[model samples]
Target: MSLSEVTARMAKAADQAGRSMDDLSLIAVSKVQPNERVASVLDEGHRIFGENKVQEAAAKWPMFRETYENIELHLIGPLQTNKARQAMHLAQAIHTVDRLKLATTIARLAQELGSCPDLFVQVNTGEEPQKSGILPTEADEFIAEVRELDLPLVGLMCIPPVDEEPSLHFALLAKIAARNGLQGLSMGMSGDFERAIALGATHIRVGSAIFGERDYG
Candidate 1:
């Protein structure tokens, strides 16, 4: 899909949900995409983006950011304790903070660096054993813990069990955010972003559907 197609679809989704398009933010997930594809999006003037790894984003975004003014970058995948400092510098937002050690590190780095972009706590609503989010039952406690650390807590993010109804997971995430008084809901991806918007996803990440599938190698 093209950038226009994605934004048009996003607008339609927001309209259907009775929300303004201006209230929603679309993050082009450029995790594994090549620079050529990223440049294509840049050429189109889409300013927001998401990436999965700090190292990869560190390697790729400086040149892009230097070329394009006011581009907002989000780190939307698992974060490591060691990379917390780098992430605090590289991303305008961090969407996968899930544990005490990492969150602790991020809090420290945010203070030491004096730069704390928006932060989202990742919750494993599906309770998938292998996933990289905090357990659903632990979300409240986790949020409280992070708050005690004085990190810039902003919202919640979740990737549902791919087999189940995405709307269910999206709603669950919204509920969690509401319970905790968070305003941002970083749910949705290419497959179910429309549904995510209807259910209250303030931020949606789109990748392959726009950039095409990536080669892991």
Candidate 2:
């Protein structure tokens, strides 16, 4: 689909949810996309883009940085400890902070690097043991722990189970954010974003729907 179509769909979803289009931010998940494709989307007035892997983002961002200084880069995948320094420099927000070690790494790096981006705590809403997130039962304690850090704990992020409806998952994340005074909900992707918006998703990460399926061969 074209960028215009994606924007229209986003606006329509916001309208359906009784939210102004201005209130929501569309984060184009440009994980495996080329820099040219990112530039094309930037031409469409999309300033926020999400990348899922540190290596891919590291390889791609330099090509656009000089030209797209105002664009916001977000890291939306599990981050490794070694990548924290580079991620802090490039990312405007990190959406997959699930462990204290990684958080401490980011905080220490942010202090040394002289920059700290917005931070969102990722919760394992589906309680999938394989996923990279804090467990639901431990979320409150985690939030309290992170509050003392210098990073801005802006909200929570979660990926629902792939096969099930996401409303419950989205609602749970929203509730957690509310209980903790966080203001953003970074839930939902292309397949279930409309439901997520209805359930109070302030930020939606969309990739396939906007850029088409990724060719991973």
Candidate 3:
């Protein structure tokens, strides 16, 4: 799908969900995609992008940051403790914070640098042990821990098990956010975003549908 088609789909989904198109932000996941593909999306007026790895983002951000002043880079994957500074430097939002140690690292770095970006707690809605997220049962405590830090705790994020229906996971995340007084749900992706919108996803990360299959070597 092209960028226009992607936006149109988002518009349709938002409309069906009784939300204005402007109410949702489409974060184009750019992980593993080349800089040229990212530039193409940027040229099409998509200012917000999501990257899964700090190393990939670090390697790609400088290539475009100087040209796209309004670009908003979001880290949408597992963040390592040692990479907190690099993530803070390149990301406007970090979406995979699942533990206090990682949060503390980010908080410390943000304080030292005099900059704190938006932060989101990742929940393992599917209870997948292999995934990098706090267990759903531990979400409140995790949020409470991170809240004490001086970062802007904007919301919750999750990636459902690929085999199961995603709506359940999205709804669960939305409920968790509501219970915690968080208004953002960074759920959904290229495959199930429309359903996520219907279930109250405030942000959807889309990639393949817009940029085609990514070649990650």
Candidate 4:
């Protein structure tokens, strides 16, 4: 689908949910995509994007931001503590502040550098051991911990287990957000974002549906 089609669907879904498309944000996942393909999307005047790796984003986006106006970059992957500085440098939002240590690092770096991006706490709503987010049960305390660190905790994020129902996980994340008084949710993707929209997703990440698939090596 093209950006206009996706935006139209988002508009319809938001209307069905008693919300406006202006209340939603779209992030094009540009991980593993070539620079030319990213440029094509940029050429269409769509700016916000998500990248999974600090290294890859650091390698690519500086030049793009220099050339383009108002580009917003989000770090949407498991962030290593060592790369916290790089992520802070490149992204306008960090969507995987999943642990106390990482939160502490971000808080410290933000204090030192005088710039902090909006932070999202990732919840492992599916309780998948292989995943990087905090367990759902740990969310309240972790969010509190993040607050103690003085990081700008803006919302909750999750990637539900691929085989399970995504709506359940999205609802769980929303519930947790509501309980914590957060208003942002980065829970949907290219495949199930329409459902996510119905459930009040503030941000949805799309890649293949808009840019086509990349067989990442």
Candidate 5:
């Protein structure tokens, strides 16, 4: 689907949900997509994008920013502590902060650099062992711990298990964020974004439908 179509759908979803389009951010997940494809979207005046890897974003966005303006980059994959500093510099927001160790590292980096990117604590709503998020049971304590570090925590993020219904997980994440006073819910993707918006997803990460399927080969 094209960018205009995606925005129109987002508008419809928000209207149906009684939410304003201003409250929603469309993060074009540009991981592994061709430069031409990404550039095409930029040419269409899309300013916000998401990248799965810090290095890929660093390599791509700087060149694009030279030509375009106000490009917002978000890191939406597992963040390595070793690369935390680089990720902070490259992206406007980081959406996979799941561990106290990593959060502590980011806290220290924020002190050293005198600035930090907006952070979203990733929650493993499905309790999937292989997933990179703090368990639901541990979310409250973790959010408190992150707050103590003053890491610019802005919201929460989750990826529902692909085999199950997504609205349940989105609702779960929204519940957690609501109790904690977090306004940002970074959920949803190409498939279930409309459902996510209905459940208060402030940011929807759409990839394949926006840039076409990624060529990982």
Candidate 6:
């Protein structure tokens, strides 16, 4: 699908959910995509994009920033502690702040640099051991811990098990964010974003749907 189609669909979903267009952010996931495809999207006046790796973002976005104004980058994948500074410099938001160790690293870096990106706690609503998120039961305490570090904890994020229904996870994430008084819910992707918006997703990460299928080769 093209950018306009996605935007129109998102608008319809938000309108149906009683949310204003201003309340939503569309993060075009540009991971593994060619710079030509990414540039095409940029030419369409899209400023907000997402990258899955700090290395990829560091490699790709500087040239784009030289050309585009107000480009907003988001880190939507796992972040290593050592790369926290680079990720902070590259992205406006970090959606995978999953553990205390990484959180502490970010806090220390913020102290030294005197700045930090907006952060979202990633919650493993499905309790998948292989996934990089705090367990649902541990999310509240983790949020508190992040707050103690004085980090900019703007919201929560989750990626549901691919085989399972996404709305359940989205709703669970929304519930967690609500009790913690966080308004940003970074849940949803190409397939179930409408359902996610219905359950309170403030940020939708649409990858191939916006950039076309990625050629990993």
Per-candidate TM equals 0.97, 0.95, 0.97, 0.98, 0.99, 0.99
lDDT tens per residue, model 1, 167-192: 99999999999999999999999999
* Candidate 4 residue spans exceeding 4 A from truth: none
lDDT of 2 by residue, 1-217 (tens): 7767877887788888889877788899998876677788888777889999888988888778777768889999999999988898889999999999988888888788778899999999999988989998899999988887777789999999887778989989999999999989999898887888888888999998888888787
Which residue runs does candidate 3 get wrong by more than 4 Å?
Answer: none
Candidate 3 lDDT tens digits, 1-217:
9789988988998888889887788999988887788889998888999998999898888878888878899999999999999899989999999888999998888889998889999999999989999999999988988988867999999999999999999989998899999988899998998999999988899999999998966
Cα misplacement distance, residue 53 of candidate 4 (Å): 0.1
Q: What RMSD does each model have against the real structure?
A: 0.9, 1.3, 1.0, 0.8, 0.6, 0.6
Off by over 4 Å in 6: none
Per-residue lDDT of 1-217 in model 4, one digit per residue for the tens?
Answer: 8778888888888998999888899999999998999999999999999999999999999999889999999999999999999899889999998888899899999999999999999999999989999998889999998988877889999998999999999999999999999999998998899999999899999998878888677
- Candidate 4 achieves a global lDDT of 0.93
Better of 2 and 4 by TM-score: 4
Candidate 5: stretches off by over 4 Å? none
Query: Looking at model 3, how many pairs of residues clash?
Result: 0
User: Stretches of candidate 1 above 4 Å error?
Assistant: none
Better of 1 and 5 by TM-score: 5
Model 3 gets an lDDT of 0.91
**Model 2 residue 193 distance off true place after TM-score fit, in angstroms:** 1.1
Per residue, candidate 6 scores C-alpha lDDT tens digits across 132-214 of 99999999999999999999999999999999999989999999999999999999999999999999999999999998899
